[model samples]
Target: MSAATATPARTAPGATTLPVADPAATRRYAWQVLRAHRGGVAAAAVVLLAGAFAGLVPVWLVGRMVDAVASDAAPSRLWWSAAALVVALVGATALAAVARLLVARTFEHALADLRERTVHAALHAPAAHVDGAGTGDLVARVSGDVDVLRTTVSRVLPAVCGAGATILLTVGGLAGLDWRFAVAVLAAVPLQVWGVRTFGRRAGPVFRAERAAAAERTSRVLEAVAAADTIRALGTAETHVHGVEEVSHRAIDRTVAGMRVSLVLTHRLHAAELVALGAVLVAGYGLVGAGAVTVGAATTAALLVHRLFDPVGILLSQVDDLQRAQAALARVVGVLSVPAPAGADAGGAGAEGAGSPAGHATTVPDDRAAATVDVRGVSFAYDPDRPVLHDVDLRVEAGEVVALVGASGAGKSTLARLVTGTVTPTAGTVLVEGEPAGGPRASAAVAAVTQEVHVFAGTLADDLRLARPDADDARLRAALALVGADWVDDLPEGLRTAVGAGGLPLAPDRAQQVALARLALTDARVVVLDEATAEAGSDAARTLDAAARRVLAGRTALVVVHRLDQAARADRIVLLDAGRVVAAGTHDELLAGCEPYARLWSAWHRGRTS
Candidate 1:
């Protein structure tokens, strides 16, 4: 909620993250994202099956030619066999190409749809979760993870499938040549199983750790960039640089560990394949020497077994890619699973406590239009160990302006966030007109203007339209004028003037005025201003303050006041200290009854007089 960006702590070594607790469940959830293309998937599978069987024709032709040569067959017979082999190879390559193309086209469509769904889920996720994860983590999921998945599907996936098909057809060829030769290859199966299982166990956690580290590194860099100005003014660039370096080292360390695992896996797989090939040769030679099969037949059996090794080798090479995709899939699935806050799109929270006990928060009536608020027994903490707001109960009657005056970290902003339903309280409830705040229509019922008044990258009209899409140019101008921003009319394009990043430059106060104009356009009854004018210099702050007062005249507003002069005009003032309301009443009432309030007022008044 703070405008200043937060610099996350350096990620520790061996740190692993998988938001979803169960990998199997996560996979099931991920499948739903791709399920729309079941027809395409089926078509690809059919093509793959046809292509694999067609490719086996060359193997049969090779066996025929070998037998013909060993038997002193006619030259014409040998030439025919060679010609047939050429034709089979050409056809096989063409079929394989078609199969690969089909799979690629289908998966590309699925990936695009999945990405859109993931973006929707992230945007609708609870604000608490978004803030907790930080910008870097979310960006990695949508950008890095999605890109990796795309590469896996496009390249590694077809390779894996083709390898499996080749291996199966080769095994069948060996069985047809001589069943004894096939048994030699089968004997090495147990070793292969053991190696794969061992490698999978070692590799899974390392892959997860690697993904998490990359995200942490990205977050560190972004945090440093966002806080560059603060670091320069405070001379903490060296400190920030050190933090980024530590996280980078941790990420590299995880990657190095994964490489080591891959090496071990590769060596073990090769050893198993070599051992099986040696057994096949020995068995084939024995059968020939005993006259159980001809030399040509033995040669054919050995060739098929050796051919099996190439595809099996290729299959093993893709294990690392598959593991990476698996980890990425789990993360994407985890994020998509976060449930959207109830009534987030609607004006109020859904039926009060649908499954909640009868004594839970009551629902506000749909007809209520007053700007009243009820924060009952509300307590909150970003970190549970350190509470920010403690069992604070408060109310602002319709049309009343309550000033919340407090020192920094006194839970002023947190209280305001809860009131606007931008954040949920850890304990108790906050309601606007009896509807739980932060409901589907929460933003429409209780709007906020925080210190970070963003003018989104778009035309001035686009920014204003965010508050009320149906508002016209006349309405936009009227709103701007209400906030004392007459200079908007002086811009080259007026309401159409470009603002925000790379657009027309706006002085901080002017941008804030744009924010107020947007707020003026909202139909939200309750308005919470959390030091919204704190960005202005003293001279501008007075002008902004006057403008704010004019705009808030008939609205129910909860202003987190930084200036005592603002508090002087409040219908009532709630003084917060260490997260509790120590006193409440008018300026004279507080000065007479509250020592802290009197001292704060006296200190401020003397400073102003001097």
Candidate 2:
């Protein structure tokens, strides 16, 4: 088929996404993330500034009225001044309300964008990287880390911006009233700076450590839940519990330490405020005695200096929250900065779309006559020091079924992953139909069904439709029947029956049958089954094996052998010992000449006989 006729390649829901780059300097990235909403941010700032200056009007008017009273001014002037005070108060309050709502609305918009970007990044990350990194790092970031940033945006950000604007306007007003009082109050600036700088430096590291501790704690919890059955089976429940307790202890210590640092900074900020207020008031008294300023001027200057306390304290108090937000933001930006895989776009564009760079798209031609998988000099490692698959060369020709037979940890599954473009090799290349297997177009031509199967919370038809959303009820039923999932017909609602969490429960074997049914719906010419029948009951394994034979009839198949019987049915059996392909032959040929294969076959036969 021509490229124009073939389906456009898509990142399948379960397909691996590009790996994120290791974090670099991120302040610029943070700005870029925020820059998308600069219009709203600027609007909020303008409203807040107007409200702040309006708030100063009442203070200025009171001084005017007091001075007029002292001078025995006209009754009309006094009444006018009093009336002006009321007007200022009303204006200030109305503007402040509008400003508060604007700021909140802006934050709501920015936060929605942030949350969506974060989710897409997670969904798009390579499956192997996500597995190796464990749930802890991501779980903490998605939950606690996001919440911390939310606090900064909704609360700390507004406090910082509003308080900063108010402080500047108050100081400027005081200078206009009397420069002596303004200068005295400004003397407290150095103290505030010292308090903030010292707190910031100390608090950043502390809060970062706290976030790390939280991740560690979360990891333990997730692992315990994931392995609860295994732990009980192995009589290691107590050990797991103890590990969780230790993690919890560390998390508690970090929280207490972070709180202590914040408390010390808060106390110091209040002390600085008291000193600044006293100095301004004492200076105002002297200025009045010197006849350089009127009593009204002294009063106004004192009130302005007092007004400075609330906003200044607010600015200082939010520093700790701001520092914590910075740490969380670094992790988020790291997710966004992941480069597209070589020769593939990240997605198309926008929130849900990711693609390779411009003009770099390449599609695997839809030529079923030559759908082959090639792995050349491929090497892989979960950790660099411990390689899983060594320098291996593998090929599966069009219309061939190859069985990879190995004991556990022999890199059979890893090799299959490479062939299916589920993961990139640490070294060397995987090509499918002459294109890089990891490339977007080539990857779409392959399908893998592994032991792990998820039944999304929906109808049975909904689960079937995940493979080909346009598949009709008749097509879905045909696919299920092909895969030996007969129980679908017996369900209370047939294909319309609800399944997954909170719905009708499916056994492990039934779930694997559902997975196979979905696999039967795909158009992939190169198919991989990685221990796909391992979770099935013995009877279901037989059913699945029969169904797999039908699926593999004319396609290029790489079968990671979970059942001993599957190897006998393959066109070629590739035996792997450690990370190398030790032997390749038909099942009968391997048993006749290969000692390693003979021994493995003998053991399996013996187990089956027993």
Query: What are the RMSDs of all candidates, in order?
Result: 6.6, 6.9
In order of listing, the candidates' clash counts read 7, 8
Predicted structure with the largest TM-score when compared to the true one: 2
lDDT tens digits by residue: candidate 2, 100-172: 7777778778777877876766665554656565667777777778888888877788778889989989989
Q: Candidate 2: lDDT of 392?
A: 88
The model with the greatest lDDT is 1
Candidate 1, run of 10 with poorest lDDT: 350-359
- Reference-based TM-score, model 2: 0.86
Which window of 10 residues has the lowest lDDT sum in candidate 2?
Answer: 1-10
Per-residue lDDT over 30-75 for candidate 1, one digit per residue giving the tens place of the 0 to 100 score: 5664576788877877777777776777677777777888888998
